[model samples]
Target chain A: MAEKRLMYGNHALVEGIIYAGCRFFAGYPITPQNEVPEYMSIRMNEVGGVFLQTESEIAAINMLFGAGAAGVRATTSSSSPGISLMQEGISYIAGADIPVLVINIVRGGPGLGNIAPAQSDYYQATKGGGHGDYFTITLAPNSAQELFEFPKLAFELAEKYRNPALILADGLLGQMMEPVEFTFEPIDPGKLPEKDYALTGCRGRPRRVVRSYDLRPGKLEELNWKRYKKYQEIIKNEQRYETFNDKDAGLIIIAYGTCARVASAAMKMARDKNLKVGLLRPITLWPFPKDKVAQLSERIKDFLVVEMNCGQMIDDVRMATQFRSRIHFLGRPGGGVPTPPEVLKKIEEIMGGGR
Target chain B: MTKEVIVAGFGGQGIVSSGIILAYAGMFEDRHVTFFPSYGAEMRGGTANCSVVISSSPVASPIVAEPDVLIIMNEPSLLRFEPRLKPNGLLLYNKTLIKSEPKRSDITIIPVPANAIAEELGQGRIANMVMLGVLAKKTGILQLATLKKAQRIRYKKASEEQLSLNDQALERGYSFL
Candidate 1:
């Protein structure tokens, strides 16, 4: 087994980036997620990587675009409002077929809402926030361990499909500390596969172009169709989720990120009192894990959807179950987080006063 | 055994650091632990608090709604966290700073003169360490040796003399009657 160390979620993200061979980072500082860039400023130097404290999120994301286009494992991070600034840059990156990593350690939002944890950016992240039709492969991790582990996975999936990847975390997950064991040894950047499409100056070969626009008729439409095929491949192969106590559950709780941890605790509390409560945690926000939710809804008639926002993920649950599973919602928008007891009470209410 | 704890104080009181040290000590012993803190404007204007969950089994929620252990380092922290303690839980307050007594009769409350003890050993900032020592002795969840080792690692940049002062403070608080 690997050695374990207590690490904060934000700092652990830097460690994960270093371990995954990401050598370029450009980010603007924001609260709750401030520790990411703060730690990156130090660790990037130690790892001999490029770390830029850009003047704005726009500058940081554009910097990421340039580095990623050059075939460097480039990344950037921001909170809700800062992330909104990166939208145009992200759309360009996605359209250009460049692999990049962007982290939104979300705080309460819509606009400078507060520096507290929230998941209100679900629609923005999943349904394509910037412009046109595009989706960043979204991953939501619930713990510091996953925060440390998901960077490598995100980078890998991004490179595999040559698409933008978003780590959709919140202030609570970013601010917490837990013991994390490094899952794999650090990868040497030199050992990673060379990119065939990178713009490497083309000294001896013919000139190449890496771009998102095409003035020629039907050229842009062809690119969109090709990207659509890749997305379908991802949806078919990459829907990830985790379930607890779902086999014989009378009521299943659907949540992700911070809310999932609270739901897990609530499930344990409900189980102690002989109430059959279960949990289904979605690891991917864009792929959405609709198949699993649909399968469970076929048998389980009761569900409680929890989120730290005004019922964002509940819509996905309702669509997955086709509005047949009697879904109950417990949403606390802005900065409010659901407690285990509060979730358990909702579970009791949904489970017909606890059988 | 699952021990949900809330340690609270002013911003400069090392409230967050003590919570991490407790969780770290538990992790060092191969137990599951989590430390979640309050950040942003709350820490700037009001009391700063952190929740720690240490359990033999895997910890689920990092947030503690009703804490079994509440360590209050300042008067404001006591006022903020006292109402949320579980019945029969343990309450350790810093007597040198907080003059008010707890109102709850169901929980066990102990007032430690953490600042006085740390001032005797030297700086007032190590009061959180003293409180941890009393917590270790009274609750038995954390071992003295583990706390010392965790303290060494957490403050690995400290000089040998400074480190020894911290150990002595923990010892003084541990031996407090």
Candidate 2:
């Protein structure tokens, strides 16, 4: 029998990790995202997994690096402030090419913002999330069901590319509860590619060194170029997005995660009023689906980018459209969630003939 | 068709659960649904609210700006959200907790002493269920069987005694309606 259960998005993440065969977790508790680690602590113990509450966000991410280098599925999560502390470790992990799942349940700010939901981390998440010439596969989930399903996808992408994967969730998506249909198929941990590069105690083979060190500048540059080539391949093959009502749409709204949900509502209301507005929601933020946006720009006269931050993703939209279409931006910064009416008003105002 | 609702009350008043049960029922009825709650520090003593949207098509937005229905378990919630009700919308208020009456003429207001009725039913917490019962009777949005399934699904992990109390709460709430 198909059963429906109400679960918060953080709880859904925990369930998704379990479903994805994640066996280790190391994280520091932070506002709006502490529930993820708290739930993992209890559930991990019950399932014979490991859950460690580290002293700091830096320590937590380093612990993830250690666990992931040992070739077992592992994860670490935090908010913006905590994620800032983890950037150094994230950079190291990205450099070492270790597959780890990092979840950032975003809140407001450049530093120590309020606990309210915000998408201000868009630039940080999509711009490699750390100091490196590498990319983190970022999945933006808009709802509880997506929260439950994206972790599995995150793990798959992380392992496939041997890179750090991120689920860029906002506080609103993390806290909301919705009816979710859990997938029944169990993820096999053994099915993942054996880490030939992992340091596994040197059992019977040559000791492996998992570092990004290079004695010569040319070698380091070569490695960076190879990583960029891999990213290019990802951009070509793994850009996932959803388009709604865009077949004959006059106005196209580009949004992702929580803001995308709001845009969907506005689009529905506009459609009811016989307005030719549609939505293009990006599920994969890094491999940004630039081609899809470019294709839509050909048909639509106007493109509106909505987000929880001030013109973060809009930069990417502009780059993709190459200023071909009239690009407009609507957003709510500093922990405030924009209502559907607010978005609708912005849409109408933008389309009301003032360029 | 989509029925969007906002249920608001104190933190411990089971307002979130009421929204959850309704959304679960929607799933049982093969409708796409979403339920969203206010979280973090606001969940402790502040007004707790959850938005539920049930629809024939996939739900577009989980946030309700102008809700089609308002289930208020307290005066604060009633006063706060009464202005956001669509024209001719249904308002179910817990008369025991909400002493003041709403002055909106366009909306149909149903006042029920849900807490008092639940107290008589041997538990005050079941007031949420009683409100749900009235909502079911008034809207006929989901079948009783679907609600029963939802109860089972929600209370699957609880002990038998706890499950029995929840079952009784649903029955009493339905009968009151």
Candidate 3:
């Protein structure tokens, strides 16, 4: 039987990491995500883990990079501007093939927008925020239960691919409280193969240097190609999404994160009014789930993309449909989230045009 | 059945805590529950509110636009949330703090003098608990036993006397109507 516990989404993510055998947490305090570090600070000691409150986001990511390089399950979390600060370090970690968890409890921003939830980081998170030819596996969770389950999945994927993984949650999900049944069991951190290539005081074995830099030109190209090959393998195998009421529907709404919940509610309202609207929620943002979108295009007449940011994921929806189907966008940036009624209005407008 | 509730009041009036207790009671009974606080740039002594939803099935939206039950702890909360309550909804307010009569006739309004009752109990802060008791009795969303369980869990860290005071406040408020 699953243990039922009521927790904030941010706190749930911390519990997920702990269950995933994450023993090191280094992060700076930021709004909407402060609960994560606050919980970790209190709970890490009980589990004999290390929790560091870094002076800056830059310092925190680097600390995560160091801990990850030393082969410990480590993570760091921040909001939009703080995520921006850690871009270079994220690129370096990916290039070095180190497994780390980067959590962005996203708030609105081009630069310091506000402390409200927004999906504005879609591009920055999925399209490689830093200077790199690499992609981090980005998981988007809509509720507190998913928030509890995704971190363990993130860590497993990160370790399997030898790359970084991101949990892209928003302020609403982070701050809200809900009852979540934890599904994953705790694992012993000592039993994992984290020490195989780790720089653990190499006495008899060869010293392993974990780094992203290659001074020679040809060698760097070879490394980049190898990384790209692995990323391609990830793209082929790791796409995850959920389709709601769309198998026989005419119109599909593409949404992710907290916006997906609102879109789901809107779809329910539309169905009540005899409008055949459905929802396609992307659980993984980086892999994009393009194949699923393309398949749905055969039956669906049009698509509506809802987001907290102005038209970020809509571009991906258009790309997936190849600009063949009518794709529309409904967004609210700089703070507020779209409600079900607002999404229902947009759905009705699209249904009017589609018919 | 699904129930959407909005509890609104001044920041220190325990509006958010009442929502938490309600949601906790729902969850303890094996129902899906969500509690969303109005946050960000919100300061103490300002308007504060939270939305709580409880359902047998999964809750689709945490945002409650038209609540089935609206609890107003102050005048500003009354003005702000009165128009948003659904038709034939349950409207519960603190009659001691709110002087004006409700304008709508379709909804069932329960007037509980929670502040006066809490004052009589020798602690003004327990007014929210009194309101919670009335809510438990009037709506049947939570049973008196479930409310007591929730109160025990919520104040597990408090002294025994404090817990008893809250229980007294709750019993007083539940019978107020």
Model 2 C-alpha lDDT per residue in residues A223-319, reported as the tens digit of each score: 9888888888888989999999899788999999988989999988777677788899999999898999998887777898888889899888888
Query: Please, what's the RMSD in Å of model 3?
Result: 1.5
| Tens-digit lDDT track of model 3 for B118-149 | 99999998999999999888887788778778
Name the better of 2 and 3 by TM-score.
Answer: 3
**C-alpha local distance difference test of each model:** 0.92, 0.86, 0.90
Judge candidate 2 at residue A75 and give its lDDT: 92
Candidate 1: deviation at residue A326, Å? 1.4
Best by lDDT: 1
For model 1, the superposed segments whose C-alpha errors exceed 4 Å read B42-46
**Candidate number with the higher lDDT (1 or 2):** 1
Q: Ranking by DockQ, best first?
A: 1, 3, 2
- lDDT for predicted candidate 3 compared with the true structure: 0.90
Q: DockQ score for model 2, please?
A: 0.67
| TM-score, predicted candidate 2 vs. hidden true structure | 0.94
Residue-wise lDDT of candidate 1 within A85-194, one digit each (tens)?
99999999998999999999998977889999999999999987899778899999999889999999999999999999999999999899999999999989999998
Clashes of 1: 0
